[model samples]
Target: MTLTIRPAVPGDEAEILRLVQALADYEREPDAVKATAESLSATLFGEPARVWAHLAELDGKAVGLALWFLTYSTWTGKPTLYLEDLFVAESARGSGAGLALFRALAEAARGLGCGRIDWAVLDWNEKAKGFYSHIGAKPTTGWEAWRLEGEALDAL
Candidate 1:
């Protein structure tokens, strides 16, 4: 099967949401996803879209997704592509879809003159870590992932 990666367009919300939920499940956060097709459409296709996504298809069948957003990096003095999620369907695990998605992201970064690409992998996902290493991606050694969401975010 031939695999292709392309930027998601307005009508892809359903497929994108499907891949996102699958990703949440893979990350052991099955119940954490609250995005609906409408929400995804608003975020990904609404005016001044804050996030972006790419879909990976094999012979016209959607099989993976790479969701990301841009962030400024003071150190690099340029925008950075922050990958929010990367997932390939269980049946397509070893079909190169993941790498194709990543390659597409890299191409996008290069085109946008982004300083770098960044993502976090769960510590327990050794397979993902290995794939990242194989792709020449090194984990950041000095920072811990932190979050201040929900009530804490609202309080602040």
Candidate 2:
């Protein structure tokens, strides 16, 4: 079970989108995925690209994905790596692919001079939360996630 994690390149958009859709399904929001391969390609492989991703493979078969972007931290006076998504196919859950992907992401954050890494996990996902705890990640307290989009954004 050879596990490998590497930065995604052009032409990997289809695989990326597939993994993203799989993630959405796992999150019980199967219809919430609005991304397409074209969009992923444009955003991730275009000139002046900002979003990035890492693909994890087990024995040469794609099994996981880690997508992220850099955000500026006013307090830290440095960049922070915000992980947009991390998903491992159910069959690959215990194959160390998830941890390997995180290791790669952490290595990237350090190489890019990021002050920290941040991500959100669903409140109902005990398995994910436990895994995060095992990784020494502490949940942010005293704050809740907020979002505004679609009609609300247009009204604003």
Candidate 3:
């Protein structure tokens, strides 16, 4: 039950990819994950824009990860922490790993003077929705999430 959360390093790429794919599978969108170790290494550690990650370890084994990046909230006029993905291994669920990951993100937001921390969950994932509610996160019912991917994404 003891968990340790820390920023990821280049050596953690494979583990991070595993966790990310697991998350995609859980969301019923297995094909959505296109990241490879080489690409992940380059994007996360390379130039242009840097993506960051935090890994959660239980009993010294990686059990979960949170991939995130910084974003600006024009309305708030401050930076925000955008949690791109959060995943806990099936065996690690209910062991407080998820909450620990969330707290770690919140702590980072606080340290950076971030105006907010934002993420989205599938509507059908009742368990996840309930957990977020239990943690006092309200769903933004007024907003609809939109995305452009594949050809459309590339066209732009």
Candidate 4:
């Protein structure tokens, strides 16, 4: 399969959401995603462009994506590219779609002069861990991932 990766455009919102929902399913949380095409378009193509995504296509159909944004690292005093989500459809997993997405992301990071690229992987996803290892991505030790959501987020 030929994998092609490119930045998402205004018209690709629906395709992007499909990949996101597919991701939620693969992670065993089929109903966890709440994102909609309207929201995705607004966020991805808004005036400020807060976030960016690169979509991967195989045989002329959208199959995967890397959704990310820029983050400033205090210690490094430079920008870092933080990948919020990375997913390739099950049917397209072994076709180098994931690697193509990461390579596209790396190119974006390099274009933006980002110092590092980071993202989290589920602890139980051994396949994902192996893939990360194959790409030379190491998990940061001594730091626990934390988040405030739902009631706690509303409380704040």
**Cα-based RMSD of the predictions, in order?**
0.8, 0.7, 1.4, 0.9
What is the clash count for each candidate, in the order shown?
A: 0, 0, 0, 0
Residue 57 of model 4 has an lDDT of 95
Q: Write the per-residue lDDT of candidate 1 for residues 1-156, one digit (tens) a residue.
A: 888889999999989999999988888899999999999998898998989999999999899999999999999999999999999999998999999999999999999889999999999999999999999999999899999999999999
Which digits, one per residue and each the tens of the lDDT, describe model 3 over residues 132-155? 889888887788999898899999
- The Cα local distance difference test for each model comes to 0.94, 0.95, 0.90, 0.92
* CA lDDT for candidate 3: 0.90
Clashing pairs in 1: none
Better of 1 and 4 by lDDT: 1
Pairs with steric clashes in candidate 2: none
Question: TM-score for all predictions?
Answer: 0.97, 0.98, 0.93, 0.96
How much is the lDDT of residue 66 in candidate 2? 98
- lDDT by residue for model 4 (58-99), tens: 988999889999999998888999999999888888999999
Find the 10 residues in a row with the least total lDDT in model 1.
Answer: 20-29
Record all residue pairs in model 4 with backbone atoms less than 3 Å apart, i.e. clashing: none
Q: Give the clash total for candidate 1.
A: 0
| Model 3 residue 84 distance off true place after TM-score fit, in angstroms | 0.8
